[model samples]
Target: MHVQKHFGKQGILLVNLGTPDEPTPRAVNRYLGEFLTDPRVIDNLPGPAQQLLVRGIIAPIRSGIVNPFKPGGSTKLYQELWTENGSPLKYYGEILTEAVAKEMGDDFIVRLAMRYQNPSIADALKELMDAEVSSITIFPLFPQYASATTGSVHQEVMRLLSKEQIIPNVNMVNSYYEHPDLIRVFADNARDLGPMDQWDHIIFSYHGLPQRQLKKGDRSGCHCYADGTNACCSSISRVNQFCYSAQCHATTRAIVAELGLSEGSYTTSFQSRLGFDDWAKPYTIDVLEDLAKNKGAKKLLCFSPAFVADCLETTIEIGLEYQEEFEEWGGEHIQLVPSLNGDPRWIAAVVEMLREEVGSNVVL
Candidate 1:
């Protein structure tokens, strides 16, 4: 008797942070509750305390559910961020996923998932398993490595796969902070805006992580915040290889090198900090203020390398909110370089990265 051999396609799971289902207070509230309560996000807090803070207080307040008279802070931002096609993050993820799938052809199956909310990791994983892929590659859409983002996504994927009776070969791309293709795409986007010299100053604003969390990731303990300075994060060493701030700096350096930006012509700062705890320093807001007020900066260009796609952070926060504040400080314009949202080059870069991952894996 002859037996049939089973051949399976490779699986690609691309995950982004997430967005609310709707631009409503309740939806935002639910989304925030799930996001903030993750231990990796609010790692400093214990489980019960974190739950209370997120579900009982923080989420309600941000969603504006506690006070019906006022529009929710995040909800209002989401409302402004929503487009005719819906949330840009999710929309771009969908487009990118479809593009990657088509590019990969019949050899691979690609799925897009959000770490939180709709099109969840669980469902994505289920689909991949159902497809009977021989292997699955998990790619979190964060340029830099952070416990709260990439680490969290990996943990969730493993947790879901742990329940399965048969688990396929798994690969996770932790951080591609200095990938040449990624840096080129960003530089190309800025070039499309005209010339690098046109802007008074360039700002590379990355999402902020609490200083305490940064230190927690440092096994050396003495590496991060040792001398009450960010000197340790200036360069990436084995001691700080996974350091988020160091990775962010590295990303900026790559882009700066590509654009031939002068040493003082560009600044690296952190943004979207929460709870007023000491976060990675030289906050973007402070940097903007100094440029406009003291340095007499007229035109500014900002790049949010932390985010691959435009969402509330890039569109509303940097594009609108920061622009407004800069103008208040007498600045002329704050140009936000577009993110890698379905750009043909960006799609090609992603496909290249995924192909590299798939090529490296042993076929079953």
Candidate 2:
């Protein structure tokens, strides 16, 4: 390990969930190796053993299966939406980082990394080390918490630094779904939707985790998986603590209050599920189909609160695929509010992350 102490600068390292190096099978395989094999990501498995299993078993199939972004020809209408910016997730992630750096002024260095692929945690830390930055704070860009997502990324980051023998006085933002400013951003999204009366349903769709994985939270009994039947989530002790479902429900409540909208005006569901494993139930496709069945949902609005920027899951899965599904089922229109990308108040939230984690005096 490369042990180092307090130095000239502090760094705010914003680590977003990664994308494949390119939208190809080879790239996806490489990305999934670093991603799915993490013990924190696929908890309960033995670490070294899981790594081997990932290499020997999972990567080959996952490569073909999990390419969130499909390659489309130039003639495809989807190609029309493509821009010089490429993937909106990476595009907005960089924009948000650079914008935060400008706002943070001097004395603080801001950098970003994907938890899985290019510009990785190792690279980000090495940059900080070269810049003589001694302290570091990691803001995993997940507003809500998940072991496979936020916690796993956090663990991998620590693992790389530990191997390098360079552990900075690191602080982490575990979850901020309840952050007042974040709530305001969601409120702004509702207003951006225009006449709310015209919309029959607002769905808060978060990324899903397998039920087994959700139950396997390291926090264990500290959370509420709540069988979703009885006081399961609330009435129980910490049993439901690590449950993403519970947190998504809480986010729905917070958003409702923020928008001054009443209950039943909205419902929360999970999206972007992979494989045949029973992920969190009431699949998004099913929900949209039901809305189509109801036939009165003239307008539909969906929000991906788990993600801060528009990514494949949000843009392609939710926006494109789900919109098509809604149309197929007969819903008139679906409007997806973009994430808090470069928004001024949202910018302040990023700054708040820096100030609270790295050090002080980070203002443009």
**Best candidate, TM-score:** 1
TM-score for each predicted model, relative to the true structure? 0.96, 0.84
110-134 in candidate 2: lDDT tens per residue? 9988888877888888898788776
Q: Best by lDDT, which number? A: 1
Each model's lDDT: 0.93, 0.73
Clashing pairs for model 1 are none
What is the RMSD of candidate 2? 5.2
| Residue range with the least summed lDDT across 10 consecutive positions in model 2 | 71-80
